[model samples]
Target: MTVDHVRSLSSGINQTGVRAYNERLLLSVLQRNGALPGGELARRTGLSPQTTSVILRKLEQDGLLHKGVPVKGKVGKPSVPFDIEADGLFSMGLKIGRRSADLLVLDLKGEVRMQLRETYDYPMPDTVFGFLERGYEDLMSALSIDMRSRMCGLGIAAPFELWNWHELVGAPPAEFAAWRDIDFSAEAARITDLPVHQVNDATAACRAEHVFGMGREYRDYVYFFIGAFIGGGIVLDHAVFEGNQKNAGAFGPLPVPDVQGKPAQLIDLASIRALEVRLEADGLDPRQLWQTPQDWSHLEAYVQPWLEQTADALAIASVASCAVIDFEAVVIDGAMPATCRARLVEMTRTRLSDQDLRGVIAPEIIEGRVGNNARGIGAAAGPIISQVLLNRSAALLGALLHKLGSERTSPFPGRTYPTGSVTGMPRAV
Candidate 1:
């Protein structure tokens, strides 16, 4: 369907949708607080006890929740605490990067069950699709029929315009240009016949962090994923803030000074591409170095300058971002090795510490736990977030309605919002 048509779909918040929302809320509560009794879940979610019990029963039957040992209270009978069942569902996360393709099968608890990765010069439509198909088949082959049936959906994480960075990626213009006409999510949907969601690779990485990593501890943070190009995402009040164009944290465009003291975007100095450019100038195989940062120890001459420049640019960006929204942490992740990430984080921290802090509280500079897999894992979560975690159709409808600032007749056959409403899109990030 068309984008406008999808947005026009009514957030059917009838009695049925209320149960769905409650089911999600119950899962969220248990996930955040561990096992809790039905009464506690109801109290936390503001759902009626009877409604909570009913939803809990249904979720239990669906294997999405499990009952723990009963706990006897002082004033009441023993109550069984319910917890999320990590194996109840699964999502397929795929990342098509400029240099590599990765596929991961993630369980409900965000654990990776299967991973397949390949390095290539650049992604070609046929090769990328073939890689995904093989990966999906391998994943299904490893699962039972019942488990396979529980597959929530597929999430594709890639750059919005893969062909646009041909120069940075060292790809032929004509070959890379082919990506301009390819619709990644649609093609995957056609091949897999599974619900597909697409997101910018950086945003997907941030979502991965939000759902499985630092997000558990901090709700507000500015996420920077240092891949081929520096990418960013923002989280506020525990939800990713996607701007009108779904590119709120496009950090590559943030301005910074270049080596020549000329004004340039952060991506020019802080991204892996910048390092690659430096390495290439010194007659080293950048592709090999990209895969193995540990080998860069001998190339200290090139590495030191890039690290210094990158740290400076990141410090400036972190200060600017915190000044605007006051994030609690600045998470840096990348396609490079973990040691590289750690060193970068350390350098960034030092640079940030040196900055003047008169009016704004400096956000903690931290290394991202997801690393390079963030985008793929987050993409895999798209289907789960949309189908099980929350009622996205309802949430998007509510957003469109709110944006319009008035009630309008919805063409879809469903109840309008009244019973309940979810506030954010399931796959916005």
Candidate 2:
């Protein structure tokens, strides 16, 4: 179907009350699993068979869902399946980094429709916001989505250290000078009225994996995002574990044993900066790093020791996490190319496997499927899901509001504003 046609079908739904809740349940099931039999969906979502039938009928009629042919089974009658019309919805995602940013438009199935990227000399909030607004506007215009309501909310992936008010209440230090003390949601709201959601870059990437990538295989896992820096996300029972300050997965600061019998943080040992510094000290020109593939290979050799150390540290962390959460695996993702991820996974597995420790099951370490765009894609998907849920709730609220005669402005929270700042920082390598 044409993009416009699909957008129209999705926009036509009256989201609120029972209808909204039903839609949310239906979409959630479809998202978690690409498709399922109507009976299976009812069983999984805990909705009455009659209720499920009604909701499925409405969704199919609205073009948000479609029915599949019956599948033959050995022991029972064939049943028709329901699947999400993924093309019916679309979302935009943006990842803001210190030196560059990536923007992507994705369909409901998590496929990239279009991408635009740019590099910047400095990380100024105002300049970044201007670039983003223009980029979003240009993308929307290109897509011919003139109506704001036709578009879902915007999601941003950024890096911001979350600390308790008592620990670091004032402005952040100079290391994070560019992003310190900025209220992104408040500022972004002034520029556009769209709903904006902010999340940590690694956490967002983890969300993308949980929703669309390999993590869908396990209910609990630790996601290590290796980029300019090293960051991570912890998922338990399919929900992200954001700590009291919403910063539980700051894996960078976790200390690892060093050669000097002291301990250094993972970022100090594994970050891209560490590799760059090592390469420069070895007589390699730093500027050639990004331009030459061979430079990366050479740098890879120099960091082998650090990589091994990182594997050991990760093994320890994995064992500890498993003891507490019984996590199934530890996933490594981010800017590392596919080959590099494979090598790391292999090395981590071998290292952990060699340990003779008792009662320790070496968790599988797998490369992430989402790659560098994981954060951006997750950022994009966040809003689409939020808006879909909100749209459903809004429909029910509208009916109540009509009966109540404006006694309630909305049953939900006030509209969210945007801030130019991206969410979660890259992991501190």
In angstroms, how far off is 376's CA in candidate 2?
A: 0.9
Can you tell me which runs of candidate 2 are displaced by over 4 Å? 1-19, 70-78, 146-149, 162-178, 282-306, 389-429
Candidate 1: minimum summed lDDT over ten consecutive residues — where? 6-15
How would you encode candidate 1's per-residue C-alpha lDDT over 315-427 as one tens digit per residue? 98999899898899999888877777889999999999888877999999988898778999989988777766753222354476565444333333442333222322221
Q: In model 1, how many backbone clashes occur?
A: 1
Error of 2 at 168 (Å): 18
Give one digit per residue, the lDDT tens place, for model 2 in 1-429: 333443343332224213365577677667666788888877666567888898889888755688898899987899888887765566777787644578778777788888877665335576667777676666665664433334565688876543221122233345346466677776654444446788787778887887789976876788888766678788765556666665667787776666575877776665555655677687975544334122356566766765676676666556666666666788987665566667777777876776654676567787788887888897887777775532212233334436544233333465222211111100000
Report how far off residue 170 is in candidate 2 (Å).
Answer: 22
lDDT of 1 at 377: 94
Candidate 2, residue 162: the lDDT equals: 30
lDDT of 1 at 268: 89
What's each prediction's TM-score?
A: 0.83, 0.77
